[model samples]
Target: MPSTLHETLIEMFRERPALAAEVLTGPFGVSVPTFDQALASSSDLSAVMSTEYRADAVITFLSQGEPVHAVIVEVQLGPIEKKRRSWPAYVANLHSRLGCPVQLLIVCPGASIARQCAEPIVVSEPGLSLTALVLGPDAVPVVTDSVTARRNPELTILSALAHARTKRHRAPVLEAFLAGLDIFDQEHAELYADVVLAALPKAARAHLEVLMTTTPHRYQSDFARRYFAQGEARGEARAVLAVLEARGIDISEEARERIADCADIDQLDVWIRRAATVTKADELFA
Candidate 1:
């Protein structure tokens, strides 16, 4: 889920801080100088991840072309206090190892009685502290503009979640909700989903067939059935095969047989999309 959202959010934070904040046009919308002065920036925080023992999608804050802070931002969809120990330790580790002023930022989906973070969270030693940015259920307002709506189509889904009552109507949230199956880390996934879904509208993602399926990608067997059965995508299967072959993906007879044996239309649909990028067709085998 972090893969779907976070890195892109650094831009939303930069280009449109208001969207990152809950308010439409208030103090939250004010752009930070950090974005303006950055000669350039990147989400390649892999180096920091190992150093800090933390998540990868951290949004780095730069000033005067120097890395001032690397925020180990955690999106806590569950219990924020539950993660207090791990998060602060991660920040402490980053600071000691990397000698950079690392900060921990905790973001909850919405306000909760369980969210007891009233101060800068500290851990391991008194020297390390992490800030909390918690949003309530109604925070991170929905899109109201035609241009923003067109640009960030993913917002439609987040907006829908605001009013959704049945699980069936939450397809948009479910499409990116890989954490429900724990396929990805749940807290990380929730945070990632928040940033990306808020930044883009669901319509912008219409081209991606994975979103249309009822069977979540975490359910490997269901992908083909859920997606392919009702899918309007053209030559999807052939496209999958062609892409795999052209990419020089190593395909075995057994693997091909397995794909053919697959009855789940949704799984096939996901496989077809993945085939378009696979370096080895063997990856498709169960």
Candidate 2:
């Protein structure tokens, strides 16, 4: 089963197919042809072979009616030896299928994983090696300005995920992230928020929670409303935990699980008040 993080990153790339090209050209300085549009291609690279080779995403850049370039976007959380072996197959098979130049882009959140993915894969052919273009935390830029975020919301989400730990970058990045949410539909916005919030450190996540609660007026659109609802749920979940922690209560794994699993606003509210006065963390549920 694909984790939420894995699916979210792949969905982001699928939502903004041009993002692959943009990252390649912008940070990695790889030359990609100017395309009028980018369309999602079949990720299944198996060609009548018993073995199935599927990539995370396959985006093709089309100029007029012809395919100019194709990109294989793979979101890698950790170093998998299996991936190292299959990645060459992904590139070669995609190139053969698209009948155009293909590039394999590995997206890794960790610096060490990025370095690992960047290592060359030597092929059986003499003097031929595949070097994957990696976009890691180091490669992703800190998109602070609202205008830039609005212009490329997908990239902004990626930026937030990469730079969420930096205190100086958090405010502007989050501001842009919130401002740019209007561009996407409710579903995408919520998923994007999930990815951004999950990537943030504790301090940064708390800061974002404060912003969401204090500035409800900023989010007036229908899409924003849905996004805010999700944020509110997260805020409420934290409130239950915070109250227990403030009173020096030890939260058991089961107690923490119950709090996290509770999504009902009214129920959580009741628990929140109980948490403040309860002597035992588990007593909040009772």
Candidate 3:
């Protein structure tokens, strides 16, 4: 099982597939084919051979329903000799599956580990080798501007993870990270906050906690209002479902998913009111 830090890092990419492309083309200066959308594809790279292979995450770039490029994301915190071998296999299998060009992007928190991961992987086949594109602490830019942070919150969070310990940058980085968190729902906001805190040094973490608690204007901003409204919608959705279930209304999978996926506060309010007296679960939609 992957460690908590590993999983949290991967979730950032999984939630925002475009972040992969942004990280690639933005800071890394790698050219990526233009695509209409980037979607999370199956990470399973298992071949017909005896051993099963899987990657951490696979992002596929699609243009008008055609695959343009695929990226395999691997988060490495320490050196593992086996990865040198498996990394090549991941690229080969995913390329064959997608029938598109594949690239391996590795995320390392430490510079030394990044160097180790960046080493070229030599394959047995003549003239065949793989060089992974590595993103380490040095590659991630320190983001202090709220405008830039909000433009790409995931990247901002990644920036905090990388540079939050630097005394000169910690304050601005934490401030920007908090500003970026406004866009996420309550759960993600809190989770990402925790992850950032964990990554910070003890003194930096203490400083952030003070900011988190004492910053009154942060909670008074429009972002806070929106965040609270999202919480209200979630609560209302659950209450609507609860009322229906208590009344013996059978909600179809479609109905359940609709309620769970809804983010509009007004729509949830309407559903909550309808759920009280509706004879059937579907009547809430009506």
Candidate 4:
């Protein structure tokens, strides 16, 4: 089952199919034929010869109504031995279906997992092997410039999430993310913000909170207003847990659910203070 982060990463690529091509040609330095349009292709790669196979996303690049290149985007959070076998099959099926060159792009947030994913996979035949093209932390560019972030907001979100925890890049990445939000409407922007917020640590999240609050009133988007108005309690709720998380405290699902369901800022604040010295998560309510 796909986690929220996994699904969101795939959605980012699907939201802007061209972004996958850009990442490939720009960062991955893989040649992709120039195309007039990019569209989502059926991820169902199942054929009569094989069982059902579904890729996370399949983007087809077309020129003059004919297929030029296709990309399979996969977001892998951890190493899965089974993927090594299934991924090669995914490429083979997609290639046969599209009758075009297919690139397997695996997006891994962890460098270690990326390294593992990049390892060559040998099929049933002794000689045949396939290596995944991985996009990991080191591969993701630090998107600190507002102009660049706004121009490629989806990419910027990936960059922000990739580097949100890095000490040097945290502040700038969050700032760029805020600027990038300008390109989206309230609903979309809010959703993106929530994702970034979920990735940040205590100090970095606080910095983002400051940046969002300090923005000029005239420059604030509807999303910005909604964030301050409705998101404060939820953000605080997360903060209390984030503090405990940073302290390496163990939390039960019941306690986690309690904090998550809370909407009172004052109560969350008390929990936040209590979270700092608590040996266990349940102590927050004690």
| 71 Cα displacement, candidate 3 (Å) | 0.3
Per-residue lDDT over 1-286 for candidate 4, one digit per residue giving the tens place of the 0 to 100 score:
7777888888888888999898997768898898999998888878877788888999999999999999999899976687787888899988888799988999988889988998888775878888888898878888988899889888788888788787888877877878888888777787888877776678877777777776573334445656776678888988988998899998899999999988778898899989989898877888
Estimate every model's Cα lDDT from 0 to 1.
0.45, 0.83, 0.85, 0.84
Model 2 stretches with alpha carbons more than 4 Å out: 216-226, 229-286
Q: Name the better of 1 and 4 by lDDT.
A: 4
**Model 3 lDDT per residue over 1-286, tens place:** 7877788889989998988999999879999999999998899998886468888899999999999999999999887598898999999988888899999999887778888888899896789999999888888988998888889898898888788888889888888887888878777876777777787789899877666655364523334455556666788889889989998999999999999889888899889889889999888888
Tens digits of per-residue lDDT for model 1, 1-286? 4534434433334443223322212213433334333222232333443543444335444555555555554555554555665565665655565465654444433346215643567553858466554333344344433344334433333443342323443443443332222332334334544444454345433422344344554432232243345333334555566677788777777776666556566777888877876667876643
Error of 3 at 122 (Å): 1.6
Ten contiguous residues with the weakest lDDT in model 4: 217-226
lDDT of candidate 2 over 136-160, digit per residue (tens): 8889878877688778887787787
Report the Cα lDDT for residue 256, model 4: 93
- Per-residue error for 177 in candidate 3, Å, reads 0.6
RMSD of each: 12.4, 7.4, 8.1, 9.1
**Model 1: CA > 4 A from native:** 1-31, 36-52, 92-103, 110-130, 151-286
